[model samples]
Target chain A: MHRMMSDKRTIFLMMAPGFAVFFAIVFIPVFVSLFYSFTDWDGISAYRMVGLHNYRELLLHDPVFWKALRNAFLLGGAFLLIQHPLAVATAMILQYCGRAEKALRTILFIPSIISGFVTSKMWVQILSTQFGLLNRLLDAVGLSTWRQDWLGSSSWAIASIIFVAMWQGFGYAFLLYYTGVKGIPQDLHEAARLDGATAWQLNTRIVLPLLQPVIRTSIILAFIAAFKQMDTVYLMTQGGPDNSTQFLATYLYQKAFSINLYGYANAISVLFIIVCLLVTAALNRMGRQEVGEF
Target chain B: MARANPAMNRKSPLGWPFGIVMAAFAAIQLFPLLWLVDYSLLKSSQFFGASILIWPKPAQWANYRIAFTAGHIPRYLTNSLVVAAVTIFLTVLLSMMTAYVLTRMKWRLSSFFYTLLVVGLIIPLHATLLPNFFIFKQFHLLDSYGALILPYVAFGLPFCTLIFCGFLQTVPRALEEAAVLDGLSVPGILVRIMLPITRPAIATVSVFSFLSSWNEFIMALTYVRSELYKTLPFSLLQFTGQYSSNYAAQAAVMTVIAIPSVVVYLLFTDQITSSISHGSVKG
Candidate 1:
């Protein structure tokens, strides 16, 4: 009992630094932001408590918050539906095709591996209206009319941002899926084959069922990326074209720092946390349960 | 059994199809990177009109220099390097110590401590922006390296410690018990006995820490206000930092910023994917 008590003290001593910073820097600030949300203060000045006015303002009046949340939803849905499915398809191919597995994985992973800021800037140059290579290619293909000011036009700006984001981050999902695939025991497939199950049937019945945990994680990660996306949007659009491409994170940033609506920004953040948690929980329940080796 | 009769059997599920598909995929993947390299050589007119997919006419490698100087890449590169290096050092140090204690010392509060670290990951960093900006301003750390490094370490430690702890869980407790019996103190047991065993986890942690520090831009832009501390990626906004429309200079500066990360990624490519698995798959 004495030994155990002393060991517990040692453990407490060890965990002190991590939680000290975690609480002060992350947790305290987050909860304090909740408090700040009820008050009106520019971040620079000492704040005055306003008693739920910020929340009221955000809920009742702020169109930008809704737009940002709406854009986040679109991105989340698009990634889960379009990007994640494509990632699974690619990962499935790479996994099944043994010879090309390594090489294909590396190739498909290049975009994700590139620095986000660099990739965003690269695409911006690619899609530039004048002196842009994408437009030039369109002109060459005789589809000149297909081009628009991609980042500059409100109609297409959000989609353009989402597309670039998908391109840059698809590698994460791909890698996750690959790991999931490789983790499955070969005996399962061998037994299925011996049982006279055709390859397609084996894949559908076995492979898909096995990769559930990975798919769940991918959904959670992809959804988080879609919401917390800051670097790409900041570099590409700065939430421009009249704020068409703003995500919740960037929008929160614009509110707190750029616009100096500290109270309102904190309000947005309180709600943002709730939304992220709910979405992640939703994906967890929706995604396949991982198989345990035990 | 799996390898012995390959020639006689002549029918393994593995085949050349993977090779062909991977090669084609590799080409597509390398194309854009190659385009950037090629574009640096040509003048603006030739570059812009040419498909970003196609090779350059002359391949003027000197464009890298033109772009570098135009972008003021030296300052941004230096700032990013300093920030990345400092943060990496601090993150590894803090997480290593915390993880060592948590894993090595079996205590009742350890699980609670571990859960506390998750606050960094799940709290939505956006919420902290205002608070941090305010705090940094209060301390006069804004527009300085300290501003970025401190917060970075805070955010970085939880994930890294978690990774190290995950890897540590697999290690049997026998080694430390044996070390304790051999008259080593707790700290000595950790530094000499346990740490050496977790080199792979350390390698994994290093990859993420370094990359996260290198790729961070929003913080760099927000905290580091001076022209001197501009990060390579953020400075690319003005195409060499002067706000000109010079594509060549922008590309050149990008090469500068991209070089270190590319080298780091190439060197640790194995570690990145593996560590990511270590971080996410277990828990």
Candidate 2:
């Protein structure tokens, strides 16, 4: 049996197809991207090696890169500060809603499952300056003064993007928290109740503390999602209104496809990957340290 | 369950507020799609009316017909379905085989290979886009379904393999040992026994792969230029250009694009949600 299981030929045959595709399609491209990042390829002309020049320009000279970086961080921060807390609070409330729990959870998760294209298109209509549902509703409610071009104006584009993104993503965040809340052993809630702890105390003092691991994971996932945001931004604004809503992925795309600066785009992608890894690593370290304390 | 938490009991003072809050949030979550559907049934002129929502006295279902014919939705939808179906099939099959080899077989570099594959979860797809474009261009695969399908399957494998590996580890070795004693070959055991056991994981992987591939926009946008190979999401971009002022028709196109994913989610909600939590937490 052991021999059969460990037969080198069979094992090799089983692994070869997946490994070949993965390497050809994903693994090799990553290395190729890294290689391209050091050159000055303009997609049309013969490329010349210019070691460190692309990164140097991207790091020190590019204001748009800085803005995209800042905007990505802002999106990440909003996910952590705004979206996560609301999701948690909603999850906490839903946990106590006896029969309606599953239905509500399903409804909340619907947004996350739909295509980003659909979400962006829907929001674009809702936020349109002339025929927007939002502004129209605001007028009906006598708040017409508050109307603004949600996706067109520079001041509101990023915030609108963030809002649409948060709306689209709220379901997944809510689901994570809901599952975490459900996974909390019933005894914890019972024990707290027996000790005469108020519901608020039971959640804050007991439930929240026990939810540390899920919270850490959720935060990490949120940051990854935020940094990786491109589809919605691309569909809605394409980082328009003079690049007001630029994200890392969209900016890299614009540089590569639109402007034909393949080398600089590759440099941006490499840094993008590094930024994601660093953020994930930092959060993981913090999580481990906190776990050590307990 | 209701008796387990008195606060959640219907008779409790907090019940009404909790129900209201949950209902309100559910409404907020669902209203946008409902409104989209509503507007899709209205005439284009009615879209700018004073009311935020108008019940179409007579529904403009023609918008859907126009979207289907004029918007080139059938071609895009066919492309999307073919790409997604092929991607899901290949990803599930390859990942299952790879998972079995990595977990059940004793090999010197199994752990190394497993780590390498699992690390793909963090590598953003943007990093691969440019290189992949050139690679596809070299192979003359641009404007072909293979261009989208290959990368989709490649990116889908890591997560699917991870899920399958997690599932495979939990299956006891006794069943496989029994199969071996019954004179079953390794491939037979894998096919007849392991595949049956991993159905839940397969469902999870299929849904994940389908969602990723079916709604994939950037790769399709980059690799496929001709309308012949464009996927469903591309229809919206084209509709935005072609029917730029036809708001109702555009809404119809958007609705059509969103329906398949919504249907899949409805069918596999439990598997999808559970797999997401399991996959991400473990990942």
Residue-wise C-alpha lDDT for candidate 2, range B1-283, written one tens digit per residue: 1134444553467766798888987998899899999989999999878987789879999999988887789888898989999999999999999999999999899999998886677888887899999999999999998999999999888888988988998899999999999999888998899889999999999999999897778888899999889999777676555578888988999889888888999999978887778755774
DockQ of each candidate relative to the true complex: 0.46, 0.67
lDDT of 2 at A21: 94
Clash count for candidate 1 is: 5
Worst 10 residues of 2 chain B by lDDT: B1-10
Candidate 2 regions off by >4 Å?
Answer: A290-294, B1-7, B240-242
Please give, for residues A1-294, the per-residue lDDT of candidate 1 as tens digits: 225324755666656666676676677777877888888888557878899888788778978878888888888888889888877766666655554555577667777766887778888887788867678778889998998888889978888888888777777777887777666676786788779886567667888877777777777777776778777887788888898888788888888777888888888888888887777667667774547551
Residue-level error in angstroms, candidate 2, position B79: 1.3
Q: Which candidate is the best by TM-score?
A: 2
Q: Model 2 scores what on Cα lDDT?
A: 0.87
TM-score of chain A of 1: 0.91
In the range A1-294, model 2's lDDT, one tens digit per residue, is 999989999999999999999999878988889999999999989999999999999999998988888888899999999999999899888877877777888889998888888889789889989879999999999999999999999879999999999999998898888887777777777777889998889889877887788888898889888889898899889998889999999999999999999999999999988888887788778776353222
Runs of candidate 1 with Cα error greater than 4 angstroms are A1-5, A43-47, A96-99, A285-294, B1-26, B50-54, B238-243
lDDT of 1 at B70: 61
